[model samples]
Target: MNRDTLKNWQSRIDALSLRERAFLLLTAGLILGYFLYLLLIQPTWQALHQGRAELESLQTRLTALEIRSRDLASGRATPEQERLDRIAALQTQLAERESRLQARLGGILAPQQAAQLLQSILAQTRGLQLRQLHSHAGAPLFNRGSAATAAGPAVGRYNLTLEMEGGYDATRRFLQQVEQLPWTLFWDSLEYEVKDHPDAMIKLNLYTLGHS
Candidate 1:
């Protein structure tokens, strides 16, 4: 059903006037751009806010507990030995929490490695001309601390946007190859314009997450 629908749309697009095709492409681009912003950016912002809240909550709670411990220690009302034991117990609790909080999330895809992989894939796709490539930093979903001290945790998603010009088959093959890559790539937006006939312009925005 989807393939037939796509064929129908392709035929319809092929039959449209150049100006109408351009307008359609523009509309599609706008829609896809908005979709990408919602998919890639909004979720990250939400996760970041949640992560900050969680970390801050943890921090505040620990602070409050430490302050209380100190107050009990400074007050002669509590025995020194008991206060020391309480402080030691709190330190152990903190260590255990930190160790558990660093739980592994998922696979890691380094920014440099991702870029290199993209370049290699594009090179293999004959007749595809890479026009532009851009990178964006990722926001951590949660804090990832030392692997030595605690369990290795997952990192954030690193983003890349690429623009290329190629024949339909080449562009299609390139996209397919990217999909086959081992990394966890999220295809946020894809804009393929065929106004110029056999050769088309393609804009691709994708993000890959880091490892465990």
Candidate 2:
């Protein structure tokens, strides 16, 4: 039937014992308490747990930041440490420069070895006649004993002189080969004169540096 009619019938019941009424009331109270826990107390408990977790995470981050700040305040590098760092940086730069120099310098060789290479290169030139070839080791560019500590390396200069007879094109090719040698060579002086009809005489002075 209608809800009002059911309520009226329930109210008309008057045969319940006091113990039965007490049990019914206790059961109603327990049911109401369960509903209250589900609607309110459980949500509150979960919110508290979530807030505690968030607080712990924030505390951990704050502790790390505090330690970093303390280190920044008291762990500044000393002058000696800065000096050592600068020296290390300079050494690294020097190493890179040295590598580049070696590449450009080609190969390191003694004066005699460089002269032999040059002689071989000249011998390969077609339509060119070699009159004379000479090579000699010269003095160092600077006094190594006094400047050794200040300079990076000791370099000694070597001299080479050549006299040849050939056409201009052949002589140019010969010079190009010398320039393309595996070791570094520097041109000091070059003199050429038209001798007879088709041939010319050339005198060349070249300098090279070697590390000691």
Candidate 3:
């Protein structure tokens, strides 16, 4: 080779081995590696992490919902149980009312027998010939207690006043007979007088009270 050509070749070879060139190549390689990490590896890792977080949140929500569903299922009531509860409540109320009614009636008569008490009373007095039966013009009321003294329940007292002409013994017998009334009956007053031009006849005032 010519001396000038060989010298040019040696200069080119030396330039390739220089520190500046090496530094430039290393910098370029480092930049390419950084871009690859940002574009591919970093995005993949971030997506994976995000997916994991979302899965965990979904699992937590599902567990909470399942627990709530289980609680609701356990607390659910059957139709029969609800009906029984309602029936029990009604029975308790009916029993309380029945007890109150029995107490009010003095526990004297059964349900079926209670209805016939007034009829039985009237039937007993059918044979007695009433001369002048004067029912007091007032409310039909009576006391629930004995003697019809208006001591117990005065708002429901039943008073039956009457004037009759009979013998003293017959009047006494009639008063005694009325004591067999079903509910209750008692004489409050009994006034007697001798009738004019009567063959041993007496006018009697009879006041009685009945309770039903």
Candidate 4:
């Protein structure tokens, strides 16, 4: 049956006009081309487009990395510049510390000032019977030659001996007031004797910095 059908169709095609045959051939070619485009050509074109887009993205990333690398190279600091920056920072810190030291020194007392202050303290101690009071000259604890020169400042220690007779409460109040002074005072020794009247002998060392 299939062979008969093919023979009939072939006879019909053989009887067709040449123009009609050419038209049919053209139509079949167009259909074959369309199928080929759908199966192979369209897929290849889409793949190529996607590949081009990916390549463009990769190129953009590469370009950005190159720019960053160049910037880093240009902005890199030399070792000498880094060292200079550190030195400047250290100098600033040193200046600040010196300022603080000067401020602290301002609160201290000089030899003459300390003598006057001690006199004032003695006057303020009410109900304190003075036995003896002695004040020695101040001497530098550091280099004597540098202290004589006006390069910076020098630290000095002054000795003071205070002997007084008073009750326990009055002596304690006096000591508290002495402690509240702005200057730094060091208690070297203290001797006390209890009898009908209590008496106290105290030796103190005072520290001061020379501004002159």
Candidate 5:
């Protein structure tokens, strides 16, 4: 029937062989899969990566905050301990104040009171003749008042100067009497002059402190 037509068809079929058809189909399938991945799977993978990064950042921030909180908690001091320390410091201050008050109480004495004390001392003197007696009263160091001590009234202090003339034995007896008196007197100065008589002239300076 038509030998020419058969030959043309056969030549056309040979141009597109089975191997070429298979290769063309494979290339078309690979292109379609790449488009699908770009549209759906690639976006999903990007979103997953972003979400993982955000989660990691949040975790790191949380860890840092937790560590800071723990550090702050550890650094906190208890109120009880702080109060106890304050109490101890206050107690020490109180004790010091009390000691200072006691010392102040011990150092207080006054002048007129010292004169009366001298009279008492004279009463206790053994054999002294009441010779020419002189007394110079100085300003009182403190008024008749309480000492700085917490327990008792403050006392006052003063300086007193006294002079007397008598025998040596009588003067010694007067000094002994002064030392044995109930109150305290500081013998600041003493001067004695010898005369042709058996008796001697004596001068004395006294510092006395007394309470009101």
Candidate 6:
């Protein structure tokens, strides 16, 4: 406000009685607090409420799916021939999935390749620093058929753990790059902690299946 108008308002406040000024101060404080809640706290609470609701819905769906899967496996009330037919169909689907998985993965000794690619991407990310890159021993994928045989084509899953510290945007870009790689990757887990504002520590565990 211009000087004269501001002074007029100040004089009017000065003319108020002690109890009147206290009441005005309290009213202003309440208004400020309400605005602060709207500007800062309300959105966080709304997000948390919505997230909890979604989680509950997902949990309900997951429970039903788990029950169905158990029935498929045990076939407690199913006819003997029907159970056998379901088994055959599941085995066929498994074989087809395995075939497609093999086609997507054409490399061997995947851990080293994964590490190299991750390092390259990390280097390219401006605000990210790599603290650790750990590669675990490969776990072989067994053939799923009437008979479990190792004589079939050998395939294994390579596990890699990546630890880094970076800004959120840079880490998000790095993850996107990893996802867009030519080979398929199974995401095991991801942990992100923010000890400092706008910067976070990230731990990512990933695995890929390929020739042993």
Which candidate leads in TM-score?
6
User: Residue 73 error for model 3, in Å?
Assistant: 48
Residues 188-209, candidate 4: write the lDDT tens digits.
7766666555544434444445
C-alpha lDDT of residue 164 in model 1? 94
RMSD of each: 34.3, 13.7, 24.9, 16.6, 23.6, 24.0
Ranking 2 against 3 by lDDT, winner? 2
Query: What's the candidate order when arranged by decreasing TM-score?
Result: 6, 2, 1, 4, 5, 3
Pick the lDDT winner. Answer: 6
Deviation (Å) of 65 in candidate 2:
52
Off by over 4 Å in 1: 1-106, 143-154
lDDT of each: 0.77, 0.76, 0.54, 0.68, 0.66, 0.81
The residue ranges of model 5 lying beyond 4 angstroms of the native Cα positions read 1-110, 123-157, 210-212
> Which runs of model 4 end up more than 4 angstroms from their true locations?
1-103, 144-153, 198-212
- What's the number of clashes in each of the models? 5, 0, 6, 0, 12, 0
Q: Which ten residues in a row are the worst by lDDT in model 5?
A: 142-151
Native-referenced Cα lDDT, model 1: 0.77
Mark the regions of model 6 whose C-alpha exceeds 4 Å error after superposition.
Answer: 1-101, 107-109, 143-153
lDDT of 2 at 43: 99
Clash number for candidate 3: 6
Query: Where in model 2 is the C-alpha error above 4 Å?
Result: 1-109, 147-154
TM-scores for every predicted model: 0.45, 0.46, 0.30, 0.42, 0.38, 0.48
| Two-way TM-score contest, 1 vs 2, winner | 2
User: Candidate 4 has what TM-score?
Assistant: 0.42
lDDT of 2 by residue, 90-169 (tens): 75665555445545454655666767887787789887887998887788655433224244665668888989999899
Per-residue lDDT tens digits for candidate 5, residues 5-86, read 9999778767897998788779999999999999999999999999999999999999988877776689644567567767
The number of residue pairs in model 6 that clash at the backbone is 0
